[model samples]
Target: MRVVQGTRPLVIFDCDGVLVDSEPLSVQVLVDALNRRGVEIDEEEAYARFLGRSLSTLAQILHDDFDHSIDAAFLEDLRHELYDRFRQELKPVPGIAGVLETLDSTICVASSSQPERIRLSLSLTGLLERFEPFIFSASMVENGKPAPDLFLHAARAMKTDPADCIVIEDSPAGIEAAQRAGMAVFAFTGGSHAGAPGYSERIAGLAPDVVFDAMPDLIHLVRQHMEGPDRHRSPRAS
Candidate 1:
């Protein structure tokens, strides 16, 4: 048997669930923040409605769900307060450190999270510096997840074509966005609604190239792909 060594593939990652284990804490923060404003919501509902959406979009969802108007400014302030309260509790997903340290690919974060929240989460997880200028937020685009604009922006910024980019996401919206962008996706089943009813089927229905039940499994798969024979092929040319 021969071992293959080649250039790494370009990887685009979702910040919240894929890199940081912040979904549960984020849901808690949202619940607390909304409750403080006299609105209440459950975690499952939050997961279903806002898991992979931008803060602005989430505000709209809350507005529609509660039949109460939540202005952009109010949502911004609430998000800031939520971060202040919950940032310290945020942590990286298991095996993330090792995966990041061992990755041979040029990895960038393309997330639906606002840039500040993304920064805060990565900083808390001690993974902020790894991405640097490559951190892309959905707020940059007119449309967020379930729309291909964010991923397209990321692929463009990285100078890699969509087909060459591999997206790692944990939400149906994120998976759909990647698919629409014509990128290969790997669904991460390690977030708030991972084992929920129809979760597996939903992921499969999206036609992801792979689905991972654990961060370690995802890490291993990335390593193997990077070490595979086609790793050296330029994504743009492929």
Candidate 2:
């Protein structure tokens, strides 16, 4: 077990694809809901567009792409239905438990998901208690992913500087947001979105500090970063 010799670094994680295995279920629910309204969208396209985005953003995309009106009330209902149908199926990605346990850093979750959804997903995945009160929702900020607001908010909440925190994300929007926040980012490519053709290159182009296709590899990278001679220095943007 590699150890990070740093003075307790901070790590912020994105929830959906990074913590809980919810992206596929989320995409499926959106597809089913839209299909019911007579809108036909490819699941792959929906996943690409909706992953790491806020519900309001998704609603707008739905309306713009299909010329359909789905009000907040209907959207809430759809989410409730989806949660009820798939909540039991939610689970953490492989090696998450070990990685979290081995971390020498303070950890928190910062996600585009609503607080309630974040609670529900983490709870269902048996990881809710691990974060306790450190979980943050994008609703807490004025803007969601692709905007630096949420990550900045998380850094402030953690009482850490953006340069001292590491962000773990699985979506392009998330990677962009972390970069914009002036934080080093690691793209996790171990979920439903991993290796989705050009995923690696797309994330690389965003200039994440690092990218990992597996959880153990990510943990090892974090350990290495923490143990490196320049552990206290802020990571340079690529």
Candidate 3:
């Protein structure tokens, strides 16, 4: 499903782990909130289960999978707390800004996080200007990751066919969604949460187009992918 036909390939970025190193911080908040209500989950469990998922998906999983339902009021408070923390402590994934500056492909962010959170995270890290009007949030579509809706919506809005796009993701849900949408995906493991138990194996098992552990390597990989037919062929084809 790796795309090789577009003149200007669209590269969709997943915000949290891929753009900003906020997963561990966000997961800590989520785990703390749930544990206060007796959910008894840990940070590693939270990341393994919900790393690239939206807040609604997390809420649904807590309810359907664990019988713990989260109300809107609670979620609102959690969002506020997350934003405040992000304002104080959030930082971009190391070396990502340089990659963004050097990448020649058309780019946009498609995140499970709210647009406001996305905006703030990028702004705090000084990455928002490059991606301002192009940020796509899960709230923009009927479904988030693990369903192809959000990514498909992004492809449509960007005027690119699914086959003409590639997603840079850091978790299984986003990789699965991109694949389902028929776009090639690259798993980025350079973020902080990647140190969690089973993180590398989890990504490896899903088999993204290629996995890279550094931002400079991503730039190199893209250069390779853009070299046309006999060059930059998808690994899946081989």
Q: Using alpha carbons, what is the TM-score of model 3?
A: 0.92
Between candidates 2 and 3, name the one with more favorable TM-score.
3
Q: For model 2, how does the per-residue alpha-carbon lDDT over 32-142 read when each residue is reduced to its tens digit? A: 888887888867778677778987677778778878888778778787887886556778888888888887689999999889899988888778888989999888988
All candidates in order of TM-score, best leading: 3, 2, 1
For model 2, the superposed segments whose C-alpha errors exceed 4 Å read 1-5, 195-198, 229-238
lDDT per model, in order?
0.78, 0.81, 0.86
lDDT of 3 by residue, 141-198 (tens): 9888877888889989999877778799999999888878878889999998889999
Better of 2 and 3 by lDDT: 3
Better of 1 and 3 by lDDT: 3
TM-score of each: 0.84, 0.89, 0.92
Candidate 2 collision pairs: none
Candidate 2 matches the true fold with a TM-score of 0.89
Q: List the residue pairs that clash in candidate 1.
A: none
Residue pairs clashing in model 3 are none
Residue 57 CA error for candidate 2 (Å)? 1.6
lDDT for model 1: 0.78
